[model samples]
Every structure is written in structure tokens, then in C-alpha cells.
Target chain A: MSASDHLIPVVVSNVVEVNPIIKRFEFKHVNGDELPAFSGGAHIVVEMLDDGTKRKNPYSLMSSPFERDQYAISVRRDDTGRGGSKFMHEQVRPGMQMKISAPVNLFALDLRARKHLMIAGGIGITPFIAQMAQADKLGVPFELHYAARSVSQAAYMDSLADRFGDHVSCYCDDQGESVDLETLLSNQPLGTHVYVCGPKGMIERVVQTATSLGWPAAHVHFEHFLAPPVGEPFEVHLAKAGIDITVGAEQSLLEAVEASGTPINCMCRGGACGQCETVVVACDGEIMHNDHWLDEEQRAAKQRIMPCVSRFRGKRLELDL
Target chain B: MTIQFKDESFRGDFTYANSPSNIPRFPFPFPEDEYMYSTNIEPHHAARAGSPFENAFDVDEHYVAEMKDRALVLADDPGRCQALPHMETAGWDFLELVMVSKARDYPDLFKLTMDGDRWHWINKPLQIDDTFTFGDSSTLPCHPMEYIGRQVQGDHAILDQRDGNLWMDAGIITAQADWSLDFDIGMNFFEWHAPVPLAHELGVFQRALKFLLTLPQGQPSRRLNWTLTVNPRLDTSPENYPKWGPDRMTVTPENIGEKVHLRVELQTFWRLPRSNAILFPIRTYLMAMNEVVTQPKWGRRLHRVMRDLRPELVDYKGLSRYHPILVEWLSQFDDGAPTSPGIFPD
Candidate 1:
């Protein structure tokens, strides 16, 4: 499963619907039968095999983290997406025993203070519902700010408002407007933490506000609905392997290594996890680490690399893979 | 996108979770942003907050930086107030814990206390007067009929007798530093959550795999505990979820001067219902990284990539968009884990 599952998956044994774009399945894993407790902003990754080759794609976990019984996730019919998401939406169906992974999360609610500021664009509201339910049960606190192109395309609104009361704030581009970043951020009491999930611009804007407020980068968090494009390239050395390969500007370090027949076990090719980690053999280049898998110390030391999506910092570098 | 409020004047260090001593005691990696923004620094200040709640999280970096070597703890962390902004979605009772030390990562933030079921920003705190008969029995949930008495802190606050839950909680950021009713800032109790994989038991994926348990009832699958961080790209990506709950989780017997090594494992499975009609039940695996070794590998890879992309491309925005949080997958190697592929493949 992708990192978002929180290492907990909602099991489904029945396929209620299937199409080239989405798959609706069901299962049981309650707290005696309880599925794991997943916060809002969580997701599940599915593994597929078109020809005995494994393929995995992460999808949004729409089920509320508050629900005890069965949970649900809605996946787009990503035909253009690799076999993982596209496969689930296209060919898989009901009564079939489908396996899912536990949820490993990067997105959870703020634990310290009372109050949650949820910003969801398009289908990003899925996980917020779960957090909302949990928030309700604890009476700790939270608010949902949902923004979408239109209400029709918006996943859930009325249910969220009804359950949450005046806490639900709506912003839709279709209405010729959307959330006012400055006003929203400015109006918030200092203790409140921010969470946003949606397109690139929306997430970035929120982060900017948080940063501008001098909120430590850690406080204002967001989950990108999609990955940004890759840029530049350079050489990486596999120290242990004593191999150095030149990554052309457009070429991924992974592609170059794989092309040379140096097998590196990699699962998520998008550089979201620490799967394709290659150690530094030696280097004389700038290091631009992009993976969350590394901590502050590693980033400071400058030895490893995620060849799949990472690029070189200097003219050359080294890896220990 | 983030909504900016006009008033930036926040007073009072967020007395998140704290212990009963004059030590900085909030856990590092404060949950989602249950942050502490205190510029208060004292050597041996200890004040007991008579209110309800327990724990600490989200220490303001500026505050943390100032209180380089101190201990802070909340004997009882008050529940998240409902009237706060964004109160609708963040519901649940929460207790925070934290500790600040002159030492680096391991010693900086330590000690913790918590329950199996977590508390959130919305839930009420436990009360000494509140009681229920629960002993690992299998029963569905429903509202209960139990009552608790109240405990007041001079004129500062009131708490439930059973569990020390407070009612009519006052504001922290909103309150003035001079607000007498708010928690006294001079105390240095340390509220904290011990890191899951306790410092002593760091292991690779292969060895870490032993601590896994399958679903006792549902289709046989497992789950694992993991931490998240932004990497590969500095951007943690659009997929990274926020940790909205308590930032600090305590290791057992934290105050008794004991430590337990943790082993987070990997659990793999598919999400499908057994009763529904389906042809193929897809199987997938999830895992927690063997953090000790894997983190280094990630650092190595990322350094090279950054060197390749150059600084202009290394802006926080590009990096934040790509950072991957704690992701788990089936381990593919013996000494180490196979590299993770891009979850959001283009």
C-alpha cells in the first residue's frame, strides 16, 4: 500500500460496482471487527500485475476515520494512470476477495490544541469526514472548509454540514470565487493548525500563508492531490557498488540505472516514499533531496538518493546502492 | 490554501501536555500543529496545572529554541475547545506530553502517557469521577449514563472529579500572558510522547517485520505504525496526510525511569468485501520502514537528486509537493528494503 494507508486498510469482500474509472467494493473490519482507526487525509495503495509484474497506485481513503464498521474509498477511472488506479476502476468487481494494506499516514489532525482547519478541494474532502467524526466523539474540535469547482463535482457537503453544524465553510470556484487565503489565515486564532488537500496551487497557497505567518513549516501542512513535474538531472555514484551514472537532463536517475541493468528494487516510482533509496558512493555535486523518507540529519549529511524522482545537485555525485 | 487571520498577537505558551515538574516536557513532532509558542524559559520552574488533561505537543520552534534545556509537562491536558476556529472537523479528547532537553533528538523530547483509544481536539478530558466497566470485552458502543463531580483550581478553573476534565476552558493564544486564569507560565513540567520505535530498538525492515499481527476476525491482513516526513522532493506531496491527533505518545512507565524499544512492522492486504460479487481480489502489502537504516539510504538518494536539480528547482514549493510521508510496503531485501516506487506515478 502507499504511505497514506496509515498502515491500516479497510477490507472489502464484495464488489458492488466497477467501471474503467472507479471501483466500488465493500468489506468488514470493525473494532472487534473494527478496521484500524484512520484520520482524515489518509489513503490506500493497491498493487496490481498486468503481466505478473507488480504495479501499485495510491487512492484517496474517503471513509470517515470516525466510523467503526465498513469504510469506503472512491478512485477515479485513471486510464492514463498506471495499472494500479486504472485497474481498480476498470476491471475489479464484487464478491471478489480483494486485499488492502494498513494505513500509513502523513496526514492526521493537529494533536496539541483544540481546533482543526480543513481545506479540501475537489475530491480531497474524503478523509476530513473521518477526522470530523472522531473530533465529534472527543469533542476536541475541528472545522471543514470545502472548495470545489462546483457542488456537483464536490464529493460531500450537506452531510458534513449537518454533522458538523456551523463549522462547515464552503468555497467553490464554480460560484465565481473560492476560499480567501489571507482572510482565512488571518482570522484564525494562533493555536489553530491548518490542513489542506487538493490541487497544487491551493495547497501551496495555504502553505505560503502559514509560512508568511512565521508558522514553522511544520505547522501548516497539506497533502498534494498530484505530484509536480520533475526537473534537471546529473550523476549519482553508488559507493558500495563503485558505479556512477550520468543522468541526462530529462532522464530519471532510475531510468539510467535500470537501463544499465542495475536492478534497484523500487515500488512507488513517483518519489513519494523511500523505496528507491541509493546510498552515496561519493559526490562533487549539489544535493536536492525530494523524498520524505529522509530526516533532517540525512538531508544535512548528503549521501543518499531517490533515483526515481531525484536530480543531481552538482556536476557529479556518489551513491551507496 | 491556508486562510490568514488578521491578529497575529498570540500570548501564553500553549500548555499542551505536561508532567508535574519544572521541566520542558512536550513531545517533539508536535501533532499536526498542536504547537507551543512560548518564549518562556526557566531553569527549575514547576507549576501544577489543576485543570484536566495530560500531554504536550506542537512546541513553537522559537519557544523551543529559547528553552533549550528545560522540562515541561501537563499533568492533565484540557480537551480542545469547540468554539475555536475549525472546531467542527477536529473532534476528540486529547492529552499532550512533551520534554525539552539540551541533548539532541533522543533526549530533546521524552516521556509520555496515553490510552489505547486516542483523545482529539474535540473530545472531553477524562475525569476522576467518570467511570465505566471496561475490561477487554467485545461489545458495540452506545452513550453511557455516568456522572462526575467537579474540581476547581483556586479561581483558575474547574475539573471533573473522576478524571479531572475541565469545563469552560479559557483560551491560550487568545488569553493574555497576564491572564491569571490561564495556566501559569513559570512551571517547567514536561509533557511528551516517546517516539514509537524507542531509540534503543532501531532495526532494519527484515528484523522489524517480526512485530506484525494479522486481523483476528476479518480477512487475514496486518497493520503497522509509521512516522511521516517529506523527502525525495522536499515537498511532502499532495498525498501526505496531516497528523491531527496528539503529537506525543508515551512509552509505558515513562516516569518510572524505564524505556521500551519499539519495532514497527509492515502489514499487507487488499480492501474488498467478502460478501460482494467480485472476480479478482487484488493483494497489496503495507509496511513501516526499518527507520534506523532506511532513513540514511533516503538521505543518500535525495542528496544526489538535489545536486542534480540545482537550487532554483529546489525551492520549498517544489520539494513540499514531492515529500513522502511514512509509507510501508512488503520488504524486498534481506539486509535492507528495496527502493519505493513513486506512489503517484505520472
Candidate 2:
């Protein structure tokens, strides 16, 4: 029905519940052969079937990049989300086959860097797990600074501690501890590259701190898992289709349109890719521009919207498809 | 005046005058009675026999002082010089272009000899003489662009033409007037200049891009853009806004003469013959309002232009609070002024 549906199939061979809402799923090629190899910071879209509707969500591969027999992905169920993680949590089981896209990496380790600083928050640690392994093989020094809600919610803490010892530092909220990103970043030698994958506030703070300290933009990298909260849903009139569609409170504009039998070609679905950019023919409401694909001026123009993440509110919104 | 630091010394060749004959030979930027943003680009023209201006790449009296400032700035903050991963070739191209420009303009002071891949470059000002193979990053002290940028007075930026759009790909821009080269890198021409008001609606930037893309490979073009600054300092970037923003609001009538400057940007655009990248060099010249008033025609025309500037444009240029005081200060000389030189082509 969509570009995501045309994917290679893999079977979930094993699952492990690391935390209250987190599960580690091990996937292997359906043909029982070696899977395609990926470097650090690669993510694959796992298409989940929710009430007969497919919801493709991106998850970072936690397993070592050197391992090609299977891919390990960690999913943290968000009960308040749009039902993709919830469906994977409640419906998916071992031996179940699902379609997945090839690994796409928007964030990759700088091999030429003198050192690598990997920082993560909550489930954002998934990507760093593979990055650290790559750094180890390349003999490049690396340190992981992780922040989690609580000790129980710090997935793979024991494994990370056992493997990395003092190199892995976890700041659990329950322990009343926090990370001093400034001190960590400031002390690093020149040519040290930093990669941050975490909550929106955490990522923004790290980037701002790095920039203020005069770090080149090329040295700082980041990735986000979830889009910001969409405000009150509204009705969207497809000008070319000559039909009015109501986008629900829990659905994206793209999803709502697809439910109406019109699916737009989208790749990242996470708002990084501009494949789903749609023109705004007319609008009587304020559009919540949440996508990173648009610059400040483009967002101010209000002529186009990325329905994959951005949403609208108020009385009426018309989109030119 | 000569300044020496760490075994590197430079002699400034600046000269000023009270009579028109002894004028500093600087190009005045105003062309009309009023100022507005437009795609005012024109083909590169040769300087006439009596013209007071220099060509696209000219080393003037401020060269030594500006180079010293560049050294200090780069020493304090190296982020000002950056070349993204994909801009390695463009960096080499930019470095070669600047070296060639200097050697051509100041043959007695600088020399560049190229034989196959080996290049022997000598810079008399900085006392730098070295021979290095082309396309080797390690052979240079730093990034290629940074190596040459430290010796020049003007800031450099290289834009690659790809997919029919010009992208601000690489550069070593330490003396940024008010923009951030780091934030603007990798952005297309329109996206980078999108925040400027009236330019988009007037199609100023769009028209400039179309003209820039069609510029012949070897024939360079030039344009001039002028604005007012609170001081002569060049690092007026948004990152350091707090340091300079308050000065604009607190300037008074008496102090306005010394505190304000007429900033002129001589922007040159040319395509690199080797890499096919467009090299943009911006040399900023600042003259104190006190010194500008000495020129009878310049002072009156500048006052009129400042007084008539639109309110929205004044705010856009961050000159809202200081412009009124500047206009009032210049009004004292507007009376019984000589018939204006009349609008001249830049």
C-alpha cells in the first residue's frame, strides 16, 4: 500500500524484555542466510501491523556492526504514541515474520576522528551500543554518557558496566545524579567528534553547549526518535482529490490520507526526509511545523508542509497534494 | 606603522588626507539618494585610469592591520575556519586562487611558481616561504583555505554549483560582518539569505543566484553592499550580538562621530577554473563617521540616505536606535553643501 510495504521480510527469532516497556528483538533473514552488514548508527524501519494497518517505525540496531547473522533492535513502548510501539509490544512474538527496510544511517561515526564521544538518553542508547563496538575494533577511544529515568529503566546497564567498566557512566534519576555534558565535552582533545542521540531537550542542550564552545558544526551530530506532540487535530481538504478528510488526534496527516486510500511516497517517515513534503494550498489555521527538513524561512512562508511529522490546528487546513 | 608579534611583522601603508587630492582612494558605496536591497550585480569592469578603486582582488593599505587581526582571531577561535568533509578539493582551489591573485597583484612582494604538482609560494609580508605538493592536506600547516586566509585581508567563501543551485560549501571566514559561516554552510544561496526582509519579495537574491550561476568560468564579477556598524570591529556575528547590540542603542550625538562607521563590503564572485567552484571574497572597509564628514559630498549624501531609509529596513539592519542619531549628527554639515556629485555607478 506504501513504499514501506515493499520491504524485505525477516523473522523475529528472539525477544528479551530489558525494562518495563522495552523489548530487545532479534531478527534474522527469512532465508536463513547472512543479513546485510551495517556500520554504526544504522537504523531499520520495522513495519508493524496495527489492526490490519501497517505502521513502519524506525529502530536503531543495538547489536555489533560486525555481526551479520542477525540484527538486534530495542523498542520502548510509548502508550501515548500513535500505536506503532504499542502494537509491537502487544502483538509481536517470536517466530513472527515482518517486513523491514534496509539499514539507513543519517548518523555515522567519524572514522578519522581522534576520539568519539557518544551520549544517549533512555532508549537512545541503542545506536551507541554498536558505535562503541566499532570504536573498539578501530582502536579509537570512546566514552558513553547515558541518562535514564531509573535504575530499572536503564536497559542493558549491567551489560554495559561489565563490558566497558568505568567507561560507561549512567546517571539515573532515581539516584539524583546528572551528566555535566559541558565538562565532558570541554575536556576532550581537539579533533574529538561527538554524537548525541537522545530526548529533544537533551540533544538541543548538548548541541547548543558544543556550538557555544566554538566546536565546528561538522563535529557535532544528533538523531531523534520521536516527533514532537501534535496539537488539536483538524480537518484537511485535499484540493486536487476533491475530498475532505479528518485527521484524528492520534494519527498523522499522512496516515489519515492513507486511510482514505491515498498513500504518499515517504522514506524516513521521521521527518528527516523531504519525500512527503506537500504544498499548502490554503489554511485558516496555524500549522505546527515540527519537521527538521524545513528551514526557518520555509516554515515562515507556510507554503509547504511535511505531513509525515508536522500537523495543523484551528478551523480548517487545505493541502495541495 | 609596523606591528611585530612572534617573529612576524607587518608594515601598514595607510594614508589619509584633508584635501580631495590626498583622499585615501577608498570607494564610496552609495549610488542613490536612498538605500534599498536589490540584485545590483554588474559585470566585472576594469578600473579607469583616474578611478580611485582597486580591482576584484587588491591589497591595500589596510592589508597588514587586517592580517594581524585575522591572526589574533584565528588564534583565539579556530572554528572560524572550516571546510566540510566534501569541500576538500574546493579548499585547494580557493587557496590556489588567492595565492595567484596575491602574486599577480604584488609581484615584488609575493611569488608563486607552479611546476606540475609542486608549488613554491613565497609571501613577503608574513615571511612564509614553502614548497608543497598540491592536493596534500598534511603538507600545509592547516586546511588549505585557512593557510592562505591567514595571510589575506579579505574573508573567503567557496560555493559549489550543484543541481542548478549554489551551495555555501566551504570557507575560512573569521571576520564575518554579522553572519555565521558555520550555520550557513551547506545551505543553498536562497536558504542562507532567506531571513533578510524585502530581498525575497523583491526577488533580489533569486535574481543574484541566476546571474551568479551563469557567470563565465574565468570572467569574475563584482558588487558592493554597504551598511553602518557600531564600531570598526569585524566580528559582529550573531554569536557575539550581546557585546555589540547594546552599543547601537546607547550611542549619543557627541560620541556618534567616533563610535559609528560606514561599512562597505566589496564582494567579488568568480568561478574557479580547476574545481569549477565559485569563489566569493568579501573585503570589508570601515571609515569612522568623523572621517567621512571631511568629504563634503560623501557626508551630505550619506545623511540623506540614512534619513530616508525605511523604518522596517532600519530594524532589519539593526540600525534602528543609532540611525536617528547618525542622521542628526550629519545634518550639521548638510547646510550649504556643494551640489551633490549626482548618483554614480558602483
Clashes of 2: 0
How would you encode candidate 1's per-residue C-alpha lDDT over B218-324 as one tens digit per residue?
Answer: 12232222223211111111221232111213212221111111111121221112101001111111111232213333323332332343333233222322222
Off by over 4 Å in 2: A1-321, B1-23, B49-53, B336-346
Looking at candidate 2, what TM-score does chain B attain?
Answer: 0.89
Interface RMSD of each: 12.4, 14.1
The segments of candidate 1 whose C-alpha lies over 4 angstroms from its true place after superposition are A1-33, A66-68, A214-218, A226-276, A282-303, A307-319, B1-346
Question: Per-residue lDDT for A1-321 in model 1, tens only?
Answer: 213223343345555443333355555652236665455555555544444434444555666665646667766554433335556655566543445555534455554445678888776776676667656655766778899776666655676777678889887778886888888878777678788888778888888887886765546767665321345656666655667677655446765676565667554445554556777767776677756557778877876777666677766676656
Candidate 2 per-residue lDDT, tens place, A136-205, comes to 8657889899999999999988899899887799899899988897898889999899889989999999
Candidate 1: share of reference interface contacts reproduced: 0.00
